[model samples]
Target: MQWSIITIGKPGHPWVKDALDLYWKRLRHYARFDHVVIKEGPLDKVEQQIQAVCGKDPCIVLDERGRSLRSVEMANWIEREEVSGRKRVCLVIGGADGHSPGFRDKAQVCWSLSHLTLQHDIALIVLAEQIYRAYTIMRGEPYHRE
Candidate 1:
């Protein structure tokens, strides 16, 4: 199974890029993991950017209004989805103002990282780490446990 993260804006900070790269490297060992950085623009334009990257794949948009899940649960969810033969899973992170209601409605699923607002750069790091953690847990590694 392949997994890709599509972000609305470029990651500007060196530290954020480094952290995101670390997780991407780690996740590559288990599955195809990559990130697509979309150009920052108007909300409609950003949505168009995301749409182009996502294509027709199953997309999970990260939003504050999305469902919250435990790490183990998320791991299981990914495993099930992959086992069911899904070609790809696209995770999207919106811009500073967040996603439009139309985008939210169009997403297959909306995932929430936390209640507090997170910078786009920081959110990318957190999302990468979670994907790594989810894979590790699915593989029965000690990275996550009940």
Candidate 2:
């Protein structure tokens, strides 16, 4: 299956960008992965851009009010999607103001990385790393531990 992460704006922090790149590289062995960037703009515009990128693909939105899943659960969810022939999945990460109610409502699944609020850049990095961790767990690699 293919996976896409659509986010608002370019990654700003050098460290976060580098870390996310590292994870993206690692993820290549598991699935086709794309890191899509939507230019930062007004809330409605950004939301539109994100939605346009997502199209009708199965989507997972990152929001504070979303469900929290463990790494294993994430891996299982991805596996299930693949098994079910849902070949493409897009994960949306909102900009500074976060997602609109409509955007969240449209997602097939909404995931919360943490209860504590995180900057968009940091959340992007964390999402990348968690994806890598989930894949490693699936592959029986030692990258993640209980």
Candidate 3:
């Protein structure tokens, strides 16, 4: 299965870029994964940029108040999606001010990394790393420890 990550704006810090690239490469080794970066702007503009990628594929939009899942749970969810004949999965990360109102309502799944507010750059890294961890867990790899 292929995973498409839609993130608003580019990495703010140099290290963030390096970290996401590392995880991006690692994820590709396990499954087809790629990132789509939309131009960042005010809430309205970013939301407009986001709408272009919303397609028939299932989308999991990240927010601070969405459902929380453990790494194992995420792995199981991915497995279930694949078994259900999902060809591609979309994960969306909003801009600096977060997603515009009602934007997340369109998602098939709404996820939150944590209750604490995360900067968009850090959120990108965390999302990428967690995805890598999820894939490792699915493959029974040692990269993820219980």
Candidate topping lDDT: 2
Worst 10 residues of 1 by lDDT: 114-123
lDDT of 1 by residue, 88-120 (tens): 899998888799999999999998998777788
Model 3 TM-score relative to the real fold: 0.92
Give residue 83's error in model 2 in angstroms.
Answer: 1.1
Candidate 2: tens digits of C-alpha lDDT, residues 1-146: 88899888898878887888788888899899998998888888888877788788888999889999999999888778888998789998888889988879978999999988888898898998888888888889988899
Model 3 misses residue 130 by how many Å? 0.9
Candidates, ranked, lDDT: 2, 1, 3
Q: Candidate 3 lDDT, tens digit per residue, 29-55?
A: 878987889887777776666666756
Better of 1 and 3 by TM-score: 1
What's the true lDDT of residue 1 in model 3?
88
| Candidate 2 residue-wise lDDT at 41 | 84
Alpha-carbon local distance difference test for all models = 0.87, 0.88, 0.84
Clashing pairs in 2: none
Displacement of residue 80 (Cα, Å) in model 3 is 0.9
Question: What lDDT score is found at residue 84 in candidate 1?
Answer: 97
Q: Give lDDT for model 2.
A: 0.88
